[model samples]
Target: MQPPLPGPAMILHRRVVLSAALAAPPLAAPTLAQAPAPTEAPRTLPARLLPVPRSVSAELQHRIAAPYPANWDHIPPDTAGWRALQAASAAEVDPLLPGLIEALRITVTPTTIAGVPAFDIAPRDMRPDRQGRLLVHLHGGGYVLYPGRAGAGEAMLMAGFAGFRCLSVDYRMPPDHPFPAALDDAIAAWRAVTAQHDPRRLGLFGSSAGGGLLLATLLRARAEGLPPPAAIAPGTPWCDLAGEGDSVNANAYVDNVLVSRTGWLGAAAALYAAGRDLRDPLLSPVNGDLSGFPPAILTSGTRDLLLSDTVRAHRRLRRAGVVADLQVLEGQSHAQFLDPTVPEAREAFNEIGDFLARYLGT
Candidate 1:
């Protein structure tokens, strides 16, 4: 088995061991167990996340601080997990996934969408009663996640709850296929849908970094004079590639897991940008003109580190005269929406459908 990427605790422990060995007294009696040390752990929460409004429940907060949830298999999008996530999205996670999903009784289909000559997944035919809305999802991993599966269980629920076609775009990822590649694929997929279906029948969607790109895509579409989709619902979007948003530093420790929000993600932004300014309005939709963008329904969890990014973007949309619906889930994180098995995840998907049903059907 591949060694798992060290989460916070493991990385911190390794750092401690390294620091202690450097500070060791030359004459001190010590065995291998007597590790060295670094500066004392801070006695209080960092000052950044404090200013942002937080609605996380005490219980949920406790759970997030614990090791990865038993229900959520959140492996890092390092090398192997990326490959696995890719394979799972192409087929299903684990060869046994079909059997497990069958046990849950969800329906899935391996089908191609109209525009892009690439692979994507759909799941709606099997569960008749679950049908409602369709959603086009863009998975987020700083454009580098391998096997970027959006998870079958969650995809099925989002389609059922969201009330329309949910086309999850498997855009070309990065360190390989950069900026315009992914954006072009998204636009093509959207055009394919609009060609046969009404632009008003569509609802664009994504989470985390995916959420940010959803906004970016719309901006680009408007600039290119492409037809605008009916509505958009981006959850906890990572829109600010330049790390100019205050939360990038403020939510640092409190957000956990996502260490140095500005570093690797920033680098990824540059790589995907293909030498574009990190803050270019086209790249950072947060800075783009959203005045005529479609009505939007955005979701964010209180404990999510990107809480500010979502809210800030919503506020901008309101200023732009674009109708915006912002929902802050009491206790959740960035990818909480992908954990459909959880009540919170289920509720998030249901709300997404509710928003689309209201806007698109109008």
Candidate 2:
């Protein structure tokens, strides 16, 4: 026969429950021989093999498939070696500038801003809305490379794409000058530019090491009571010289450009630091207070070695109650967003342009 269904009163009754429990077989105590063994948690993750993602543009995919740089493992032995390396790198990049400049319909003129050498880039056909807006650019080369005109390519690209007049600071680098020299030059340029242009209509941008310097410049400006820009775009910024970011190791070999910090990147950091503390706010702006920084739009890639640096900087800005936007592209490494030919590159510049337009005044 079927048992009676439990009513609310029967279910709530402790005596009825006890009677039912008494009719059931009691559970036997666990024996030592049958006890489950304790399991220790795994301490490490297994290595993963990742393939080039098909989601990105074909051009970007091709870049992702390219082999790592041959000189990725070479560390400069001395100042001369570093200079030679810089020259070699500049040689490879400089030749491409003429075509890019011509195609982009921009002109680059060498000039001095407060005694610091700089490049003035202007689009031939400037947009009406951007006529009074100005942008300061700092070129990236790990603080030892891309001196003089070689560093102006990024400025030219921005001038052409973003349609804003750009001042690219040809900041002094290490071996001959180190530490404060680059920062000093950048500050000098900013002072000169801000004196001429309305700070409310000005913006700052850079990638990698230059991005780090851009943030540092803002910090230094705040300390000196200088006016801040309206907005900033720091893409894939190498803001943590201490190598404390997770992507530094996670994306080591995965990043085609900056393969790992253990390579020349670490050496470059040491050279730039020049015995100073890596965590110094100027040296590594991620550690600095970002309470009053201007609105920032940061960009990074899924495969960028400094992805964590950019992410950390974005989080810090947001935590400080600053308006911050972060864009992480799929399957990119290092400053691949700066590649002029790729659609993603154009998209990146367009996003920065939009952000600047939103913040900068007429």
Candidate 3:
């Protein structure tokens, strides 16, 4: 007989339990003395009977088969575990800086925007039409990691591929400052950039937490009576910090990077939010008013844990009468569009470039 379907409350309860378990510290590894003895080999299942999808790319399949830490949710924010992750990110990213700079044909100059620390990424040969156009990039790490130069990768990709002048915000995160810190930095950066460039020729974009922050920053700008950018791109945004979205449950372990809402990202959200309600428009931009917001282009993968968030944001933007476009890539995971080797990644950015070119006056 087929298994009975679960009730809504039971499903929610199970998710909550899974999230809580993920947030707890991992159990100690088994020593050789306590390890289980070898057992008789079992018969292997046929390939045709396997549940895996065949449509996914070989690159992604290899990634799926690789071993990764399963207890990342247990890592405390601002602690050694978190720092280790940050250090690993630095090791991986720092080496690529020179190559990225050369490959993208962009120069990175240290500067301060609106009194917030930032890097100006400009094409070596600036196009006359792009002189007035600017794109502010907020790097993503769930607001708890990828500090310093490590956060500049997304900005580098945009500047290189999209042929736009980009400013990457190295926003502050916890261990020093928390919620409102990143937001404050983004606003200041916007003010600083807009002070010199025409706001009408400006745009904003970021992935994951950065994407969510882009929306939060725009909402704050509206409240402050500041002019909005010509257009915006919130890529695979972490829109519902409260973890209320459907993909958070449906795509859980299926999403390779973000395995579950109750994982590191969720823990990071709790840390960044401090004691605030997650559903606050500033915290969860999906719940915010998008009326009179700027034109937007959102992107996500079919397997993204935040796919629902992207979909919801796009629907909301359209419902509010804002011009919005949604691009859902096939057989990819969260933020896989950043991969340099993927053709779809190139196409995604090219489409974004075209969108910005149309809206931001070329």
Per-residue lDDT tens digits of candidate 2, residues 1-362?
12266555645576545654555535253234432355544236678877888898999989999999998979999999988988887898888888989999999999999999999999998899898898999999899888889998888888888898999999999978899999999998898888888899999999999999999999999999889999999989989999999999888899999899989999999999999999999999999999999999999999999999999999999999999999999999999988987899989999988998899999
230 Cα displacement, candidate 1 (Å): 1.2
lDDT digits (tens) for residues 171-210 of candidate 1: 7766566787878878877777777666776678877767
- Assess candidate 2 and give its lDDT: 0.90
Runs in model 1 with CA error above 4 Å?
A: 1-62, 68-100, 103-105, 114-133, 146-154, 160-163
- Candidate 3 weakest lDDT stretch, 10 residues: 27-36
Per-residue lDDT, model 3, residue 273, is: 91
- Report model 2's TM-score to 2 decimal places: 0.88
Number of colliding residue pairs in model 2: 0
State each candidate's clash count.
17, 0, 0
Q: Rank the candidates by TM-score, best first.
A: 2, 3, 1
Q: Model-by-model lDDT, in order?
A: 0.65, 0.90, 0.83
Question: Candidate 2: lDDT of 202?
Answer: 96
**What's the CA RMSD of model 3 in angstroms?**
12.2
Where in model 2 is the C-alpha error above 4 Å?
1-48
- TM-score of structure candidate 3: 0.82
